[model samples]
Structure formats: structure tokens, C-alpha cells
Target: MSDKAPKPLNLLDYHRPKRLRLKDARIPPLNAESKRCLRNLTAYRPSRPKFPYPQTRSAAVLVALFVGRMGDLYVLLNRRSATLRTYAGDTSLPGGKWDPEDRTIEDTARREAFEEIGLPRDKLKVPLLCILEPFLAARNLIVTPVIVLILDNTLRFPFSLTHSPLFSPPLPRFPTEPELIEVPYHTTNEWTYPGPNDTTLTTRAHRFLTGREAGGIKPVFGLTAAILIHAASIAHARQPDFEVELAPPEGQSREERIAWAIYSSPVFHEAYEAEEIKVDWAKVAKTAGGKGGGRSTRR
Candidate 1:
């Protein structure tokens, strides 16, 4: 394969000289099934997550996903600035500590994104999917992982969205016409593929970095890897993979194993035992009397 970068896949006038499909508009389109898989992940609550350490400070991170040009999905990741005091230069989901003025952890994620990187609120219009089971960081921080969706094409956010719980099986929905936008070509060199040419970063993430092939690729340890594994599993499982020999001691299948992985890790167990995990839905959503909402632990 050529080592050259792929030509920018701008959708403007893109399908004119080729085949046209209803989804061939600017920004990517997601069907009902994809949304269903995501809902299942967001609503997943582990019975026990390790408790957060009392001495730890609280922080949160954003796991943002967007559809790629070829209909594949890509999660946002940043190589943290090397100058920071800790976890500096590590690959991370965009987020930071909750501040007094922020309405919720979701707000903190978006606000930090704007403050850390330059994702202006105008350019990014992500809808809050839901928060994942919290994970504890090595720094003694209880961290909530917030999931958000990047809508295809539109620059502004839709005021409100409604959807059912993940319990119902997903029914297929067809693509509706989307408002189009002409994205001008502006190239930057910072973007790099996180995995090998043959496989996606999603694949390497689920198939954890537990082997000799660990060189060169930035390590995605513990919670970050777990979140990616969860999200990537949902994204790729639209057509399920064949069963693997690996089983979680109880002889459960792949789906069962995926669910089990969250709580079995050290973070969840420690957090649960320490009694540091949050249970109130409204509190976790940051809608209480203005303070004291938190979630966390990891393996």
C-alpha cells in the first residue's frame, strides 16, 4: 500500500461524478441501529465499580465519537501536552477537573475542550449520550467518562433530542436528507492513524495492547482503553464478529464478556468497596443543589 496520505474526502460535489446515495451529504449520517448500539453502552451500569479513594480529587473526561469518511467511526484522542505536571504527554480523552461555575461534568468536558484545544462551541455540536461507569486514575482522582455524539454536517446544535432507553431492540431507520455544507480544504499535519495500516485503532483497542506489537503506538492504559473498547465494540458490532475461544470463566459469549469486563477490573471493585461511586441519576447528571455529584474506578 502507498504510504501517501489519502486525498481529502470532501462530500461537496463528491457524488456528482459517481454513484449517489441519500447519505451522500456532508458530515456523516448514522442510522437507527448504530444509535441503538450506543444507547446500550450508555445505559450500561455495572453493579459494582471500585470506589474512589477519599483523598483523590475529582475530574471527568469526554469520549467523543464521529463517523469517518468511509462510514467507519473514529473516537477523538489527544496526545496531552508534555508540559503538564502529570499524565503529561499521555494519550487522553478531552476533559479536566470540574469547576465551581460549570453546570455539570458534561459542561466541564465541553468547556475544557474549548479551553484545552480550540473546539469552539459553534464548530462542535455534540449531544450528551450518557456517562459511563466512573474510573479511578492513578493520581487518586475519581473520573466520570461522559459520552457525546458529533452530529454529521450541522454546525449548530439541535435544541433538544428524545430517544427511548436501550432495552428495546433497535429497528432500522433510513437516512433523511441533510442540510449540506461546503467544507474548504485546510490541511494540518498533527492528525495520525493510531494503529497499523491493515487494522483500525478500534480493532487494536479491543484486542488490547498486551503483546510485542506495542512499539510505536501510544499506549492506551486502563480506563482510556476500557472506554475505547466499550465504544469501539459498539461501533463495530453492527455486524457481530464470530465467537472467539476466550471466555470469562463462566462460559459466556462475547457480548456477556464485554459487559463483564467493566466491573471485573480493579478500579470498579476498589471504588465499590471504598463507597465512592455515585448512584443518584439526577446527581450524576449534575442537576442537584449545585454541588457534590461524582462517579469513578477502573481495572
Candidate 2:
């Protein structure tokens, strides 16, 4: 091995959010980006293991990303069964408690996803590209977000009218347990990435809400939404077209606020402000004086 230390990234300009895109099939490109960019990614170590209690339960959620039927990217989400004892009927990523049989938290994520949704082991490509910072859900549990990418070629659809990773066999079969059945997976409820012309983009000021009694999607608020937004942003980095706009907005949607909170969480902010993630992504505009790196950034 060469005994050379990597050169540091020059952030004077990288700090500003710019439209970004990578022209490659692989998400998070298997090959290393420029040395500076690659090295900067190393600086971001998600903040966790902060608590000392051994009995405190540890949980993991898979922020599974894949090409959708129309070629656009989509993530998997589920509504909790109304009968479940906790957070029943809430929308969430596929996951659960870390199991002793699992070798790592990532294993917990995959295992739970398999048990809960029947995602075949063959569908998964990269088991883990990176792990985001751990979050404490509204409840007391410590939850970790695991990012997994599906093989672009493995997914197939009946027809190619508009998307990729054809999501045929529309819904996954749930386990026999009635409690698990309460969630009742539906094809219509999955969150759609807002395209450029999406009506939601028109305002950029309003929050997307879920009406519980109306038989709509379970609201994606708080930590879950934050993790998703974070994943979506990173997923596109490998595309030759990904870019961030340089602007800020007054406090608006709960998502921008929550995402900013996680990104600026004491641990994340320290690494970010230091440009450990490469460029100093502008502070979310909602902050008192900082300009948000991305404005109205929709999937």
C-alpha cells in the first residue's frame, strides 16, 4: 500500500448547494468519487451510542430505495396495524427491534423486512451503503436508519410506460398474525417522489398531511420523514443530474424543519459545519440566520 495521506477537500465553493447528478447505474457509485469528496464522506460519523443503559432496546429501520415502475425512484413504507399495541396505524419504514440472532443492526433491518413484508433476499443488492445517524423516535426507543439499495436490473414491471424497477406483484403478502395484518398494505398508500411539476412543489410552504379518518396514507411526519428526505437526497448523488439549490426559506413544512434538525443535530452539525461530508451544505433556511442549502427539495 502507498503511504500517502489523502488531500483535504477544498470547500470554499463546495459548501454551496449546487445541482448534482452522476451518470452511472450504481447508486452511491461503487467506484470512489474524487479523493477529496470520498475522504470528506468519511468525516460524517452518525451520532449514536450516546446512551449508557444496556437494557434500552435498539431498533433498526431499512430506508430501502429502488427504481420504481416509471423509472423514478421510490421507497418502501408501511402503515402500522391498528391493533398493534404501539403507534398502531402509523406509517413507517420496514423494521423492528435488533435481534440477538442478527450479526449487526443491518441484519435486524433485513430480517424484519423479510419477516414483515416478504422482500426476497434476491431483491436486495447492496445490503448497506451507509448508515445514517441514529434517532430516538417520539417514544423512548433508539432507532437506526439503514440505507439499502436494490439491484436496478432485478426489478421488472409488466409495461414500461413511465418507470423503473417495475413494482409488479403490487403488494407483498403479510404474515398470518392478525396484528401484522392490521397494517394492511395497499398499493395506493406509498409515498410518491414529487416530480418537478408536482402540485406539492407549487407551495413549498405547506406541509403534506395525512388524514387519519379519510383512509389515506399514514402521515409521514417527524423522524420517519426526516430519514426519508435524507435518503432521497443521498440516493441521487450518484446520478450525474443531482444538484442542490442555494437558498433558504422561513420555517415552513415539518419535513424541512425535522430534516434540518437531524442534519444539525449536535453531532451531525459538528461534522457538517466542519465540512466532514465534503461541502458545507448551507444551513436549512429555517434557522435564524443561516440559508438553507436546499429549498423546496422534493423527491
Candidate 3:
């Protein structure tokens, strides 16, 4: 009314560019719940008589839990080189027996991971997921499996002489098959020589005592399987809607087709494949809230 032609309605009020701009913006702290859930999970302790079996020696294993942009989760596994002394060409977690320099079982897991897979501890945003009870399978040693969540997407690994060339490749996505597999413990009953013994020595050679089968449980049985089952339970409890369908072509007989599906599935491949299901990122962004868009505009 002050002779300014009604002071023209405010641009923000009429056009609302701020609101539209915010409509397309992504959610802040994209990994908030994941981080929190991992934290709470680490704090939990399983009941006493923690280990069901008796262990004669101490050993450790690590399960690398990685979450991708599309919210898909994966675990890292290494295939031992066929030329190795033991467990050659077998799939297993990246870990080994505790060293004298190690402080805790966690330290052993970290150190072993660094040595076997070349994943630097600094590059990972790993939170302790869980500590599984020790498992024994005809072996004289007790094995502990530790699970950790890897939050960073750009993580990398280098190949070592003892590992297979396949695992040397940069793994930005999950593996198509089960990450870890247990093989039977190779042993021999032949006696070893003991020089100048009054009584003949009958020492049985049990060289590969630790490399034992996981019984009848999808080839990844034993302590490693226990760790996975527990971690899956925890994740399901937090997000009931989260589902993990196997990357299709599960039983296909064709090698090429199976390999193709493995490398193309959203759960496996780093690059998008035609067969991969497309997620509506816009809807997700809006649900998370844009900068200035009306809260109820979606309706």
C-alpha cells in the first residue's frame, strides 16, 4: 500500500527456488544409523560358556564387512595360492595365529589382515561388529572369528606372493559365492625320526591340523559360519526390511553365464549392470529431506 506496486510478492514466497533445490539434495550423514548400529553391536557380549568346544591352542580370523552406496553388504575372502605350503587354493578369512607382538585378539585380526590382504588399517572406518566363540574341529588349536564393518567405499588391497592372482585384483564389490570356505584338515600318521632314542619315537605328523572342514554347513561351517550367522541376525534385528537375496543364476551350469552374473549383480559388480535393479535415489533423497522443500510436499 506504500506506492511500491504492493511491494511485489517475495520471490521466495512465490517461486520458492530454495524449496525446489532442496528437493533433489541428498541426505546428510548418509551412514548415521549404520555407524550407530555397529557401535551398539560392538558393545554387546555373548553369554558365558562363550565357546562350545575346547581349544588346545589359540588362533584368530577376521570377517571384513563392507557396505556399498546402494546399502548392499559384502564380506571379503582370500583364495590361497596353489603354491602355498598349506591350505593351497582354499578360501578363508584374512587372519592367522596371534603373534607375540599382538596385544589383543583384535590386534591379531588387524595385523593378520594387513599382512595377508594389504588393507591398511588407516584407510578403513571399521567398527568392531562381534567376537565369536572359539571353535575347534579335530585341530589342536582354538579359532576365534572377529567381524568388523568397513564404511569407506574406496578401500583397496594389494596382492602378495603367497596369495592367488584372482584376489590381487581391486575388489570394489562383493564376491558372487560365499566369501569364506573351510577345507578338511590335511594330516599324516607317519612317524618322524628321533636321533639316538632308547625307545623308538612314534610321533605322528599333524602338519595341517588347523585346516579342517566345517562339517556339513554350506562349506563355510564352523566358527566362521557362526560369526556370519550372528552378524546377519544383528543386522536383521535393526532393519527388518533389509533383505539379502542371492545374486541370481545361483545354480546355472554355464561358467560364462555364472561369471557374468557374479560380476554384474548389484551385490557383486562395481559398475552397474543391465540386470541390476535400479533404485529410486530421488525418492530416497526426498525421504531424507532436502534443504528448504516443504515437509509435506510429497503427498
Candidate number achieving the greatest lDDT relative to the actual structure: 2
How far does residue 136 in candidate 3 sit from its true spot (Å)?
1.7
lDDT of 3 at 66: 66
Tell me how far the alpha carbon of residue 242 in candidate 1 is from the true structure, in angstroms, after superposition: 13
Residues 31-126 of candidate 3 have per-residue lDDT tens digits of 654454445555555433311111113457777766556444556766667787866665567888755555466666777887888755642355
Count clashing pairs, candidate 1.
14
Quantify all predictions' global Cα lDDT against the true fold.
0.42, 0.43, 0.42
Which portions of model 2 miss their true places by more than 4 Å? Answer: 1-56, 122-126, 152-215, 233-299
Residue pairs with backbone overlap in model 3: 185-211, 185-212
Looking at candidate 1, the ten consecutive residues that score lowest on lDDT are: 161-170
Task: Provide C-alpha RMSD values for all models, in order.
Answer: 18.5, 15.8, 26.1
Give the Å error, residue 27, model 1: 5.5
**Model 2 poorest 10 in a row by lDDT:** 10-19
Candidate 1 local lDDT, residue 298: 29
Worst 10 residues of 3 by lDDT: 8-17
